[model samples]
Every structure is written in structure tokens, then in C-alpha cells.
Target: METLIKKNQAEKQLGLGILIVVIGSVFLLRNSGIDIPRWILSWHTIMLGAGLWIGYRRNFQGGGWLALTIIGAIFTLKHIVVFDFELSRITTALVLIALGLYVILKPKKVTTFKNYGQANQSDFKDLNS
Candidate 1:
């Protein structure tokens, strides 16, 4: 339990440090007369970094936030280079297909109920009596 607490604290510290570095670098770039786009400097980037950090901190127990981070980063790539929207569309389609295949190929669990008929008959007889 103590080790877990320490690990959580370490993660928090690491996240904060990363946040500071990102913010500092943006400011540094601005001070150096680099014309960063408004969108790149917006809250969206911050949120994406936060989501990625949180996902990592939690060891990716749930994939929702991590997925959002990935998608958001992919979209943001357009700002850095020429990313065609068609690429994102293709990625989405591929993800859907992978999910469908996983669902189809995954094993199903079958539950068995033993002596259920006997239990029901006894209960029915008791009620009738």
C-alpha cells in the first residue's frame, strides 16, 4: 500500500514536470519570434497532453483517454506537416474493422446452471401445497 502511494505521487510529480516543460517551451518559442499557430497553442494541446499523462499514470487500465490522445494528436499532426484528412478516415475505418474482427474472434463464455429444474419443481410443489 505504501509503495502504491509512492508510485502515485511519483506519477503526479512526473506529470507536473512534463506540463511545466511543455508550457515553458511554448513560451520560449514565442519569445524567440517563432510564429506558432493559434491552434497549436490552444487548450486542445494541453488537454491532449494531460490525457496522455493521466493514461500513462494509470498504466492504461482504461483505453478511452489514451485513444482520445492518439486521435487528437493525429489530427494535430496537420499543423506540423501536410496530413491529408483521408488518412484519418482510413485510420477510423481500420479501427472499426479491427474491433469487429476482435468481437467475432473472441471466445464466448457459457454459463451452466446445475439442478435448476429440481429446484424449480420443489418450489412449485411447495407453492401448490
Candidate 2:
């Protein structure tokens, strides 16, 4: 219970830190007269930021966030530059390839017993009886 509480506190601190940095940068950039797009404050930006935070904090196995980041980035890029390619098809193919590679390359865990049934064949005999 204590460990859980501590972990929760640490996460809260991390969230607070991220919030402060994001807010500070936004205000600072605005004050400096930089052209900040209104979309920066949009729901997409929130999702993107959440993805980045989760990816960094949880080391990418956190799911949804990584996908969110990828999709958000693709959409953001499309806005900046027109592309004639089938983006969804390409993205799907790439994701499938990545999954295949992970399945093929990920390490297999091996389990071993220091002593099988305490080296007693009676362990099995008792089960049979």
C-alpha cells in the first residue's frame, strides 16, 4: 500500500512537471511574439503530448500513446505538406511489418528448475496412485 501511494505521488509530480513546462513554453512563446497556431491548443495536441509522455515514462510498451503519436504526427505533417501517396495503407503495412519483426526477433524466455520435484520420483508415483 505504501509503495502504491509513493508511486502515485511520483506520477503526480511527473504530471505536474510536464504541465508546468508545457504552460510555461506556451506563454513564453506567445510573449516573444512567435506565431503560435491556434491548433496547438487543440485536442490533437493533447493526444500527441499524452503519447510523448507515456512513451518516455513507460518505455513505449504503454500502447495507445505510441499509435496516437504516430497518427497525430502523420496528420500534422499532411497539413504542412501535400502527399499523393496512400498514407493509411503505408502506415498499416509498416505497422504490420513492425509487428512481424517483433515476433521474430523478441527473445524467448526459458524456465528451469534447480531440482525437479526435489529429485524424487515418488513425487510422480504419488500422483499416479
Give the winner by TM-score.
1
lDDT of 1 by residue, 43-94 (tens): 5566667667776667655657656665666555434433434444455665
- Whole-model alpha-carbon lDDT for candidate 1: 0.67
List per-prediction Cα lDDT, in the order shown: 0.67, 0.69
Cα error, candidate 2, residue 76 (Å): 2.1
Ten residues in sequence with the least summed lDDT for candidate 1 = 77-86
| lDDT agreement of model 2 with the native | 0.69
Looking at candidate 2, what is the lDDT of residue 65? Answer: 67
Report the C-alpha lDDT of model 2 over 1-129, residue by residue, as the tens digit.
Answer: 999999989997989898999878987898899977665766766676777777767756645766887666555443332255645445556656755875676556678887867767565676678
Q: What is the lDDT of residue 54 in candidate 1?
A: 70
Which residue segments of model 1 deviate by more than 4 Å? Answer: 78-80, 83-129
